[model samples]
Target: MQFRHSLTRCSAAAAVVLLGLAPGLPAAAASSSTIGVAAGANLEGISVYDTADVLNDEKIKDALSSIDFNEPTKVAVFSRQGEYSDDINSETLAFAREEHPEWISQDAEDYGDYWADGYFIITLSVEGHGDGQIGTYFGEDRKVSTSQMESIHEAGYEDFNLSRWTDGVIAVGAKGAKIMNRPWYKNPALWITTGVAGGAAGATGLVVLGVRASRRKEFEANLSTGREHLSNVTMDLDTTELSARTLPTGSRHAADLERRFADFMAKYRTLFARQQELEAATKKTRSSGSGVALSKDFIDTAQQLDATDDAIIAAAALYTRSATWQEAWRAQTAPILEDLAELPELLGGPDKKLGPAGSALRSFADTAQQEVQAVGTDLAAQVIDVDTALDRLSELRKQLTERLDAYAAARIGAYAKSEAEEKQMRAKLRKQRYASTGTRSGGSILDVTSPAEFFWRVSAFNIGYQSAVKAVNSSRQAASSSSGVSTGYSGGGSFSGAGGSSRF
Candidate 1:
């Protein structure tokens, strides 16, 4: 979705006059100490223009100052309030061009959408309270996995929803730093370079000897945490396996659980062996007093073991949810039935007070209800497969959302009185939707008063049957991916298809 376009570039003074925005960006003063360590000068290149005046500039600067990066990196946070091009990436890039041309490089050989070799942009646009889009464009040097990007967004989106402007901005920046900045232990490149420059044997002898003890202590501390997490997961596996053994003989759920448990247990045994090897190696290294750098390959295997816990949790929840599914199916379906029954009332009854559209809506609802109920009957009889049932239920949910949104669009405004009210209503509806299934979905289909407000809702009505579909699909990822995060993306951009409307 990347586009190539050149914008009208302007100098800072003319751009300010034309755009009518004061720079307002504070220079990050160099500090010898910050947050109990040396404050990074890396964020000193950060340009935060709170042009919307919603954020506390000083607070944001303070948060940014506390963070550091592995390289010279520049970040910009642009908070704007108004009608935008709906594509935040495009708008943000355009902002960089017209407002801060210095951020984008004029050298054709060096770039595409990214302004420079080490710059990134985060743009937030709000049209009304509780509504806005947050978009990020990353430079190659600052690129992250989609999972990491989501983690960053998760850290801030709720705050934005709550109108904690300062907190949200700070959270986004802080999370970005945490992800982009590699801790000394996690970064193998530094170790490899050091080992090569100095002798590979006991590279600790090359630097200050004090560093060896500290590094060893840090590694052990991290290893202890990993062991704790691994132990808890191991216990969970034990409990689940014991439960599986106790299931009724020939139970289908038991078979499924047993299969997954066998696969997981095999991997778990390997991890335990590797863990023992690591402990043995550490003891040897300590006894030798050589301060040798051990192979970090174990770190990867350790991470893989930690990720296995996600799959175990998913399998357990699936087993538990499947056992009592009938009750949940009935509860979730009841709301849809109620909504269908209330459709005629909403459209001014059987006399067609709302006319042809109302009649068409009723016809659509009737057809959907009949189809969904037939699928439900099959579900009750255990004749319908899970995938097929999910498909039908998901289709029904979509139609209901489209139809209801249409009807609401043609009818009243003010579904919410304020941003706070909109959030409250959406949260309450979401709660009702997932109460039986134990899953929460994002989005709103409430035909809210402002377009911006709908952004916060995730564009759906999670109040009825969709929750059932979500309840299963939600855990599917956890069950499938060991890391519980998506894998792979194009080198050119963020998401899998290299998404967003930023220009090259």
Candidate 2:
């Protein structure tokens, strides 16, 4: 049963600002450094094995959201239908079979969904089928569903469970990793998938680069360290401006500027603590389910903070440039500017000579004066740059708070619209479920009393019960091939082998 949901756009700003990432203002002094190389780019492959139960589990779905296989990441996403044991007997099985004739049976009662594009493996007796455990096995051991899960645990990885669908998928990916990590000849499946195994019929397989939990942890730590360093550098620059303002004219020196920078560096340790606090607060707000207002406030505040931090970092760069100019003026250029002031006096004095030395001296004075003035102008400009960045950060923080307030005011209307959408979705699902299954009469499939419903259900059962099951190519054929055409994995299979090899 397919539920077509029409989510009326009640508030575009609410939709865009709340659902998507808040619009970000680039940090005035933001560096062009990449956050970190995404591991997904180097991922060998990805596979999603969804047992029927997983479709109804929201937590599992949310966990799987981060692993996108459709993009150009090295990880190929494979969608596979996994089997779960339900206590439906022969009559129910026969009815379901009659409805979708193309689906094959893995056991006396278990139905297998087939697809041509990817590797498929049938694993029966997966640990939780009767007794709750997790494993997968291939070839002759394919009947043993627990084979894969057990092998993974035996290899020192964590035990797999259907509840952690994402983890199970990762485990399946590790099998591909073991294959892909091998030498070329040893990985014929990769050769075939990448078009190297020409005319090889059974070479369809995936090359997964499964990231271990440890690697993910390490990547996160490295990312956090990078952010901290960046924030500290920004704060250091801001503090340098404070000292720069206090420096008397002609007293500025490279040593003094560096000393101030060093002082700020000492003070930088506490900024990391503040950052961690903000992160903790944001996480708490998200987990609390405090509605859109709180969530939006946290997001807006976090963005503003990030912008402020970047500006501070940018200011530091500008401040450093200013300090360099200040140092040059005090050490060398100040003397030139002073000498240029005396040039008019020297030229007007009684002993003024029109010799080469006198002409050279006038020329030197002229050039030195310009250089000194240029250095002053450059330094002033850098100061402005730092001040402007700081000002922008202040303004951005103010704007975000105001925007969040407005969003909160309008949140009630948005919630009402969303509730209406949900109601419509539920109504559609109810209509389809009862219309197709005929009201779950007497809590038994054999007891369906409506002649019209019975005939339609029986027709669906007939289609699914066919013995010789093959991959149906067209959408039309696939529709009749399943009991509830759009309810499960109908028209969802695409070619790109991702799991254990399946021979049709």
Candidate 3:
């Protein structure tokens, strides 16, 4: 029986070997991130080499040697000091090609099958700060991506900056191992290389898995709709701007924004365009009663659109206060602090009221409070502009809100009599949050863009609260509010090699 099971895995691995016969367009990308510190990881049996002598090499190796990597990937660190350039990305790829040609994938389509052949190559070019300065290279067998590379780079940000080079090495290795390791089921060659009886079951499972894919896809539809409605009012906002020309520049901006917003509601009645069409479609969708089931397509699209809608409404409110200056800053800043202020209610002190997750949430909350306060100081001192302050605050809001919502749901879920109820409740929370954005539009981008008021509102829409809640520097947008695709590779690979780079 054990042999049969192993055979089953081999068969799947064999089948998966054929997955990438189609050509994969090569890509190179990276991003920047800076967060507080965390502890280092153990890298016992892994092969690590420091091609560039930065000092304390043996010490780095010794600390990492504490943990065993049975898959034990080889790691090579390449360091140099210079200005930021695209060369770092290409240079890392070149090092792998020249020194470790054996590591490149024999097949062009290889994506994480031969794990043992993978290498984590870190290229550190210091005397540089922010993004794309720290480069990473992964062997074809290892298959790291742009997003994963960024996470790995971020893992070592603190240690790397302090020139605790080895500690930085250990941090990245631990992170890479954690990210690279996957279940045996992932190896297609392992599952299908053996025989027939197991192959049928495996194939069937793959097909069934494809049936109801993708909450992200669903979320996208809604976000796309919101963008359409916003764009529609572009000209109207433009007109408002023109009308305000008689006023002084700052006053014109203030008058223009106010007029644009008023026109938005007066013309279309709150974010929707062609109200009659939407009402007509609603009546058509309903059968004999008021209750109508939303299609999966409709639900996903609405969710994403609403997230954008919330950002817009939140922006509008803040824009209104933009002229009020201090009040606008307060509006931009208060929600996150208010949310953090409630942490103790859920935390219940050191006793762990919500279990391990609760404790974890509180720890993050504390960090968030300090950061928010610090930013507030910066804003008051004029050390940072309002846009910059909003960028910082927006990121904090996304992180806290997502976590708080989850913790709140978990608190509610705790009372459910069954596991199914808990899951259902979680889904209900997400669905309701996505749907709550009050973006009632049934038209396409073109349809919504038809009105003169539409053009104008979208024109001024760029002004206010948008940046306050959408941090430009975040690694990736939070899932609850982001309009990105659900998952997978973020899909970029280099023709030169498989790995991508990230900033430290």
Better of 2 and 3 by lDDT: 3
Error of 1 at 408 (Å): 26
The runs of at least 3 residues in candidate 1 whose Cα sits more than 4 Å from the true structure, single-residue gaps closed, are 1-37, 83-85, 181-184, 187-504
Tens-place lDDT per residue, model 3, 29-74, is: 1101121112333232344445455536676566555544424466
What is the model-wide C-alpha lDDT for candidate 3? Answer: 0.48
Tens digit of lDDT per residue, candidate 1, span 293-400? 332334444444444443334333333556745554554355356567766555553335545546667797789789878987887776875445545665665566
Arrange candidates by TM-score, descending. 1, 3, 2
Q: Model 3: what TM-score?
A: 0.33
Cα lDDT of model 2 by residue, 1-504, tens digit: 123223333333333343232366333212213322233333322333333343223433343334322223232222233334321222122322464232223443232432222222322123342222222222121222233323333331232333443455454444533432233223345334436435344433221112233333443443355454545456455553564454333322323333434444444455445445434554333233332244333333333333333332333334455544344224323223433565565444442454443455456556545554554565566644433432332233233223322322232223223554434433433344334443221111111112223222212222321211121123336543433201112232321111222111
Cα TM-score per model: 0.34, 0.17, 0.33
Error of 1 at 497 (Å): 13
Better of 1 and 2 by TM-score: 1
Kindly report which residue stretches of model 3 are placed more than 4 angstroms away from their true locations once superposed: 1-55, 70-72, 97-118, 129-132, 144-147, 161-163, 184-496
Alpha carbon lDDT of each predicted model: 0.53, 0.34, 0.48
> What's the TM for model 1?
0.34
